[model samples]
Target: MSEPILSARAVRKTYQSGDRRIEVLSGVDLAVERSETVSIRGESGSGKSTLLNLLAGLDKPDAGEVIWGGGLGLDVRSTFLGMVFQSFYLIPELNALQNVLVARRIVGGIGSAERARAKDLLARVGLAERSHHLPSQLSGGERQRVAVARALMNQPQLVLADEPTGNLDERTGDSVIELLLGLCADTGTALVLVTHNAAHAAKTSRQLFLHNGVLQSAPKPIQP
Candidate 1:
């Protein structure tokens, strides 16, 4: 079998609050293969977001390691792991294409080829016509699409998304989810998504549940 694209082994995270220590995750283990989508389901305060942060290297774990295949290692924040958030964290001043271009620039110097690639990615996300529109001028779904395009600017090996559809209507959320999965499928990028919606969990190849700072496989065929 092919090696996992990303793997987290016995990961743990803890934070201190007023002289009290809170454990957000404990001994969590997960593996995601290339071209596969993995859903993480949990209630509020269940540490799903914390786990995602660790996997993406936005935050460090208290213990354990995250290994990346393809010689990427655990330095995801500095590596080619892309991330999208529910808040549509786009730059309000920059247009859609510019937002994506900015991400490419940060990964390295953006050349003409990189700019063209960003434009193409925006088009792929169905934002070609709105390339010049700023986040304030776009709808919620459009802004999220721009964020998705921006995440792909580096052609990342892994995409980490936190509640990516939580801010949209059902129809819009479904469309956005489809777009994300489609793009990841086409690019062979591994996806680790966090959501509370059971229906959304069913879309992924595997589903894991987070509870009380622990992670386990979700029940098969998560009920909608």
Candidate 2:
């Protein structure tokens, strides 16, 4: 098999809320290979986002480690990772083009060519015409599309998306899903998506259920 772009072994996490310890993950393990699409599905409060945070190095596990490109998260550097969230977390001040460019600017700042690349990314997401619009000016789906383009701005090896379509209508959400999967496949970027929508999860190459703080294979085909 191809080497895994991201992997977690024996990951454990817990939280203490006023002396009440809540265990979220217990020895959870995951592996995502290059250009592969993996979906994580679970009921609410199952800690799916927590696992993603650990994988992205946004949070650390009390035990175990997350390895990316054969190195720890910090060792891998932020440029290797891209993130999209349920909410379109676009900067209100920046326009669509600038929003995408901001991602590149964060890593090493942008040059003329980088600006051109950002435009291309927006075009790919079908937002080239809306490139000058602000978040308030765009519709829900358009904003999400902008977020998707920004996630790809860094050309990251792994893209971690948390409910990318959660806020959109069914038709718009389907379009976003197709665009996200197609872009990942084209760019060879590994994708790990966390969503409650089984029909959406079914489209991925592999589906895993997060239950009781552990990861397991989905029981059967997910009916739409």
Candidate 3:
């Protein structure tokens, strides 16, 4: 098989809380191939978010390395990495289209073509009708959808999402998950989704469980 789009080798993370040291991750290793979806499931405070941050290079791991194929190790920033958090980090003042356009401009450079691509992404996320709506005017699910579109605007090789469905209702969450999976498949983008919902994780190609700062593959394959 081709080299993994993203790889983490013996990754470890720790934080200093007051006078105490807290270990968030312990020698975790992971690999994501192109166009594959990998779900990381864990209870709260099990380091799921920390792992995502490390993978995306938002935070440096205390130990181990994150290697991005076709690029050097994680450094200033990774152009091939995109991330979405539980909180919809959309610019409240910007409309849905503008939010996605900004991301496109950041990675792909500003151009009429990039703006058009941004519009296409919003449409793909089923937010064409709400493109002009601000985050405040959109529902929670709508806002998350806008975030998803923004994350995809760069056509990243790897997408990291943390609790993507944490804020939506069951039905809305399911729809959002479906949209995420479908878009990633269509675009051939690898995804690493961090979620607590077993049902949500079950949608991915592979599922991993995080416990006590360690990660292990799920016993059973995740059925669609």
Candidate 4:
């Protein structure tokens, strides 16, 4: 089989608060296969976000390392990975289409083809009509859809989403999750979703729980 798209090897992380060292992660090991979807569920303050940041290379672990397949490295991160956050981090000034295009700012090659792709992604996320609206003009769900389009802007091999539906109502949140999964499936992109909602987590191909600063697989497959 091909090498895993991403791997976390014996990773550890800690945070210091007034001389108190908090162990956020402890010797965690994980491997994500290409095109596979994995969800991590945990209680509040369980360091799920910390683990995602480490895997994304946005933060370094206190020990061990995160390895990327296909010779991927931080310098070319935008070309290989995408990230989504609970807070729709769209530039308030840029419209939906422009916000989606923002992901390409670093890895420039923008032209007609790229613009078309951005439009296509927005459409995929069910935001084609809202492409011209700014974040302020869109509702919570629409804004999140724009963010989702932005995340897929680069066509990365992997996407790490941290509580993408945290701000929406249950019904809207469910739809966003479905849209995300559908888009990822169509693109053959691997996904690592960090969330607290058990129902949402169950949608992924695999489920895991974070506890005691370690990653643990679910007792049985949670996919349905």
Residue 49 lDDT in candidate 4: 95
Tell me the deviation in Å of residue 170 in model 3. 0.9
What residue runs in model 2 are displaced by over 4 Å at the alpha carbon? Answer: 72-76, 222-224
Candidate lDDT scores, in order, read 0.88, 0.91, 0.86, 0.91
Question: For model 2, what is the C-alpha lDDT against the true structure?
Answer: 0.91
Q: After superposition on all CA atoms, what RMSD does each candidate show versus the true structure?
A: 1.8, 1.4, 2.3, 1.9
Summed over model 4, clashes come to 0
Task: Please report how far candidate 3 places residue 62 from its true position, in Å.
Answer: 0.8
For candidate 4, give the lDDT: 0.91
Instruction: List the pairs of residues colliding in candidate 3.
Output: none
User: Can you write out model 3's per-residue Cα lDDT over 1-224, one digit (the tens) per residue?
Assistant: 88888888999999999999999899999988999999999889999999998888888899998888745665424358777879989998899999888776555568888878888988898888889999999999998889888888888888899999999999999998999889999999999999888888999999999988888987674567
lDDT, model 4, position 108:
93
Residue pairs in collision within model 1: none
The candidate with the higher lDDT, 2 or 3, is: 2
Worst 10 residues of 1 by lDDT: 70-79
**Candidate 3: TM-score?**
0.93
Backbone clashes, candidate 3: 0
Give the CA lDDT, 0 to 100, for residue 18 in model 4.
100
Model 3 per-residue lDDT at 86:
91
Model 3 spans with C-alpha error above 4 angstroms = 73-78, 221-224
Candidate 4: residue 198 Cα off by (Å): 0.9
State the lDDT of candidate 4 residue by residue for 89-112, as single tens digits. Answer: 989989998898889977896799
| Regions of model 1 farther than 4 Å from truth | 70-79, 221-224
